[model samples]
Target: MGPLLDDARARGRTVVALSEYGITRVSRPVDINRALRRAGLLEVHTQDGMEYLDPGASRAFAVADHQLAHVYVRRAEDLAATRAALDGLPGLAELLDDEGKKAHGLDHPRAGELVAVAEPDAWFTYYYWLHDDRAPDFARLVDIHRKPGYDPAELFLDPVDPYVRVKAATALARKKLGMRYRMAVVPLDPSPVRGSHGRLPDRDEDGPVLICSRPDTVPGRVAATDVKSLLLRLAGLDGS
Candidate 1:
């Protein structure tokens, strides 16, 4: 990539490099769905001894993603009750309602009724089951689509399982032989995850970065949303 960038610069081609956000260190994992379930707002269904979230039947449930979560309330009447139930939850920073969502530019039809932000040192987890034994089969595997929310724990092998590596190797071998395999080696614990993003960075140095090949073409600061227009202008396609 470095050589390619140098080559592009030598060729006088305009280049723009950017990132969505920077990850920060996080230690606290907030069990948002568990809290809602305990509050009688979240509902789950049992299938073959494993519990899965039933969003349709649930009065309220949270879809956690890194340091943020969207709390979907089934009915407007249950909004106050759901909000009250989440009160005093540890690692929670703030709850965004209608006005708050508008202020944050999150007021969309698909967005949840309530949005939750976590503290600087904390993050939200997708774990809902109280016990590991009753967890869904996909909970231990790297099955992203099956899970309701983002799970950084999928990046790691289960450290608690002594034979996790062996099992993973075996699963790969089985797949190579054209046999059915389930790579159920991901850990249920979220403590191993040390970094996450999604919340606004407290420091500018910890935020996203944008680098332009031609320094004169870009301002000293760039807004996240303005990147598209800036790129278009740089490419001479914005009708400047």
Candidate 2:
């Protein structure tokens, strides 16, 4: 693989390297939605064998993933009470306000009004209900749809169920990136591994091909594109 990449670079092809996020060993898991529910800011219900939050009645709630959680408040009038409830909660580092949102490049419509950053030693969990039994079967079966946020646990292959190799591939294909990107779920044939999720398929596969809108931004290659864009945007010189 290294030799192939080197040959590509020698041929004047560019490359870029990036990751979705970093991982760490968490000492404990913090369920922010549980805290909100206990404070009477959020509501949970089990209907149709599924446990989910009642978004209409909730004042504030968090959609959590590994180390980050996006908290959405239903009413602006209840923001103060919601903050008071969430204040000093365990595993919560800081809540991002408007300034903090802008500092973190998260001041966008899709982002939540308040973002929760977890402590380095603690990770966020998407468990809203206290009892696991009351939750849906998918909750324990490595599902991505029932949970509001991302779940890295779905990367693993279930030993009991060999058919569903890529657990989260179905959900990620439907809900992630709003279908802007293509997803490929491949099985590890002749290998010890079961399957992999969210990967680009091999060139031989058939279907609509995924094309990059900006082909200039290549991997394994470093350029001033990011820095220049940031500087120009900050200086009000970039149109966007």
Candidate 3:
């Protein structure tokens, strides 16, 4: 179990598991406009205008890749602690290739190569890509589910039901929120959202999916150049 799970169990409180993206985002909202400075548990650094992870604070998350994802504790002080962790996290660059090689038994060579350019360990938990190491491992998911105050029923989503579809959508929503894809608990009991692929005539599927939350989360797919500009300029990439 993670630190948060242990803490929740020790305190005899139900872990507010993030069963979907919406629940996780609300629990750890991502303020896109805010640049990460200091992470509560991790020491983040920048050199030559490039951000890097302080290996001291991050534990190599086990996945197909060795340095697949990072495991860090969420701070009780601020929800933005996660945001700070996300923004300051090291992007996949070869700066630490030698150090990364020290780890064995991961598909990092193959999978890492694909994602190391755009996102490294930082994007592992956020998006479904090469580094999504924390995703369900049938072997280990039970310990995670059986923890105190956890409801195992949240694991499965019924495809035909809209309520379950919303739970499934939670995965995407959580990614947009930039929280490590963990467990979530929906506030209401089965108030499902539509799982319709029905596209709006005006909104092309190629366009960025626009989700209106408190700050209106937007995830659009554009050219690499456009993505870079948005991350670097609009999102304060240098600062992060």
C-alpha lDDT values of all predictions? 0.93, 0.62, 0.30
Higher-TM-score candidate of 2 and 3: 2
Candidate 2 per-residue lDDT, tens place, 1-240, comes to 799777966876544333432334456567788888888998877787667778887888888856678889988887787788879989788788879889877788978778888776666667677665566555644456767776554554544555554544665766665765322232211122222222122222311222222354433232333645643543457996
lDDT of 1 by residue, 1-240 (tens): 999988988988899888989999999999999999999999999999999999999999998899999999999999999999889999999999999999999999989899999999999999999999999989998887989899999999999999999999999999999999999999998999999998899998889998888999888888888999999999899998
TM-score of each: 0.97, 0.62, 0.17
Per-residue lDDT of 1-240 in model 3, one digit per residue for the tens? 688667866876433221111111111111111122232333334544433344354322111122133222233343344433444434332212324434422234332211121121111211111222322232122233322112222344543445645654776688789966633332212123212111111344423332322123234433333444544543345674
- Candidate 3 worst ten-residue window by lDDT: 18-27
lDDT top scorer: 1
Model 2 ranges off by over 4 Å: 48-50, 155-240
Candidate 1 segments whose C-alpha is farther than 4 A from its true place: none
**What lDDT is reached at residue 130 by model 2?**
66
Per-structure clash totals for the candidates: 0, 7, 13
Clashes of 3: 13
RMSD of 2: 11.5
How much does each candidate deviate from the true structure in C-alpha RMSD? 1.1, 11.5, 21.8
Query: Which 10-residue window in model 2 sums to the lowest lDDT?
Result: 188-197
